[model samples]
Target: MKEFRMAIINLTSSIDRCHNRLDDLDSRLKKIEQRDLEDQPNISGLVATIDHLKSELNVRDQELLANDVEITGISETKEENPHHIVIAVATKLGLTLEDRNIVSVKRVGTTRGYIEGELRPRPRPLVLRLVRRSQRDDLLRAARVRRHLSTVDMGLPGDTTRFYLNERLTYSNRQLFFKTREASARLKWKFSWTRDGKIFVRREHGAASHRIRNEADLQKIFGINEVGAKE
Candidate 1:
């Protein structure tokens, strides 16, 4: 229900601190060994304290696992009349989005596509959730976190997906989010999402029309990365 991020340095530093504690314990234990058992320092309390700290650390790890949900970075904010701009790409020309000569650069303040409606909070797609966890789930536990690919049941079959945040932003800033269908990337797909993190895709003519999360799936579904890559 809640969300969190793991700071690698802070976590490793904590572990390092635990290591430091162990070193201190080792020193005290050695001092105890050097002295006669009857004259040794009070090691009983120290051992108990160390064990208890370890148990607390284990609890922290589990709590981290429970709050492990994540969504990819999508900057758009919801607003009135949120129409998406669609750009037309020439697929038969052997061109790529990077080819420069093939696709038109999103001109400053120019509209290519649009989505209409008042702003509202909505549930995001399950596939997009998994992709974000895979990318930003810095702790690596997201690999096992399962999610469902779905949209809100607004009783509108026309709306294939819904997300928590349905805000929109100006075209130029953070307009694109990338997902790969491959376990390891051989191809890359660009996607857009609602403020709630659900990817917006109305299934079109070809199988390639669906949003792809990894390159392998992209290859299997369409065998391409760029628009032309599939064509």
Candidate 2:
């Protein structure tokens, strides 16, 4: 009878220890979960801070490129003078530009390697920067009058080649512009264009256009959540 009583006490003690261990584990798990929940807001705040910095950086880039323009379809030679080309283009556009009006002009990429007995011509785009914003604006306005400009007008060898003139945007802005155009096309928007380093999209025909300054504006217009519209 004494042994039976002792056995009962041992079993009860074992059961109590098991229960205590389970309780301690539960408490530890709850703490871990609480810590994770507490850290979420901090992570979100850091992400928001990063996004704001990117936007500000983009704005600064736009300001820096305010007097820059990009020209495509201009044939390039091994020893091409970009300044002379810029002068020719200005003269073709019927604009008188003083030497001081142009800050610098250069091709944006490397020339293609030459191949023997090959007739194909590869040309790189020209990025031109003017001393004054007004000169850049005047050039853009003149180029806009004609949907496309012919290289022949600039007195280049090939009269058959035509070129396009556009604003010189930063890499990120270029990506954003491309995405905006794709989205607008998919949604059947009436018009889309860029002006003064800003992207604009018109949802309806004859309606006022809205400027899209960042990804958030695109999300609102497209009616998508954060993850879906991840830029």
Candidate 3:
């Protein structure tokens, strides 16, 4: 609970600062535009501040995104609870579970069937869907790459796939190019391309969009819709 509070406080502060800085820059730009042929002073310092603020804002946003993802994942694991999970899903619509609707909560670890001699978890029916495999070799290669510290193809014995900062990995019939940026003297990060040609990353599987060099070269490699999340 304390950690959650801290996260909220940090996120609020970051957003306030980001907005204040951005509003300041926009106001300055508007004044400059409205002025007669006067040469504007070097707003380099202001520009630098905006850049720094944006980076900070991006970090906070990514941290919040990761936190939300974690909370959602943990909430899903609650399906193991012996308590009844009320799934009030609307017809033709998908809904995520939240803490408010959960009830009859009892801690569970092993199979819960033996507890009540007949209590069983509700079954969820899955609708199967088929997707055609890509025929192109390069496209296939682009879609199967994994972004772990290292990867292995179980199909091949004694063969492991290895990747460094600049290695490209494929996933779900799409190519995910892995690249790194120097965050600090001792730290660097791996980023993957988004489906919309954006450079969004999450800390777990993605971090946040650095949007530096990746945006410039993304189109050349994947075109407009190539590297984005699949529809």
- The number of the candidate with the highest TM-score is 2
Question: What global local distance difference test value does model 3 have?
Answer: 0.34
Off by over 4 Å in 1: 1-34, 39-41, 68-231
lDDT (0-100) at residue 213 of candidate 2?
81
Model 3, runs deviating above 4 Å: 1-41, 70-231
lDDT of 2 at 153: 52
Model 2 residue 167 lDDT score? 87
lDDT tens per residue, model 2, 79-178: 6778878888888788887668888888886667656784655678899999988889999999989666777756565435778788899888898888
Name the lDDT of candidate 2.
0.83
lDDT of 1 by residue, 160-202 (tens): 4422211222221122223332211333334333222222332
- Per-prediction TM-score, please? 0.17, 0.77, 0.21
Candidate models: Cα lDDT each: 0.34, 0.83, 0.34
Model 2 regions more than 4 Å off:
1-31, 110-122, 157-159, 225-231
lDDT of 2 at 50: 100
lDDT of 3 by residue, 161-184 (tens): 332211111221122234322221
